[model samples]
Target: MENYNKLKSLVASIEADADKFFNNGNSAAGTRVRKGLQDIKTLAQEIRNEVTSKKNDEKK
Candidate 1:
């Protein structure tokens, strides 16, 4: 549960940062934001896998 909350907060922060960069209309900033967003997506996927594995273990 804590991991889930942490992942949610991290995603939200990345989204907010991306929005700020997007609003500024800077190409370099936009690129950085895109990279950051991608990183966040990867992290989220890993977290999801961890949670799913834990759930399956509990069921077993």
Candidate 2:
């Protein structure tokens, strides 16, 4: 659940950059947004693995 919160926060943190990149044509913000998205992908994968592990544990 901690990672879930982190995922939420991560997305929230990137919102400004996303908005800037899409609405204001900021190249630097676009770079930051791209980096943030990659971080999001990694964090999402971690959360998926954590959930899968917990689910399998419950089957025991």
Candidate 3:
């Protein structure tokens, strides 16, 4: 639960940072922000998978 919450917060922060970079018109910074956003997205997916697996295990 804690891990999931942390990942969610991280995703939110990355999204906000990306928006800032995008609005500032820094192409290089925007690229970095995109990369960070992708990483956060992957982390979020992993967290979701872990949560789903845990729930499945509990059901079994």
Higher-scoring candidate on TM-score, 2 or 3: 2
lDDT of the candidates, in the order given = 0.75, 0.96, 0.77
| TM per prediction | 0.68, 0.96, 0.68
RMSD of each: 2.3, 0.5, 2.2
Q: Candidate 3 overall Cα lDDT vs. reference?
A: 0.77
Clashes of each: 0, 0, 0
* Candidate 1 ranges with C-alpha deviation above 4 Å: 1-20
Instruction: Quote the lDDT for 38 in model 2.
Output: 97
Model 1 lDDT per residue over 1-60, tens place: 776687677767666557767787667767776877777788788888998998999999
Candidate 3, 1-60: lDDT as tens digits: 777777777766776667667787767767777887777788788888998998999998
Displacement of residue 5 (Cα, Å) in model 1 is: 7.5
Give the Å error, residue 22, model 2: 0.6
Off by over 4 Å in 2: none
lDDT of 3 at 36: 76
Give residue 16's error in model 1 in angstroms. 7.7
lDDT of 3 at 59: 100
TM-score of predicted model 2?
Answer: 0.96
lDDT string, candidate 2, 1-60, tens digits: 999999999999999999999999999999999999999999999999999999999999
Query: Per-residue lDDT for 19 in model 1?
Result: 72
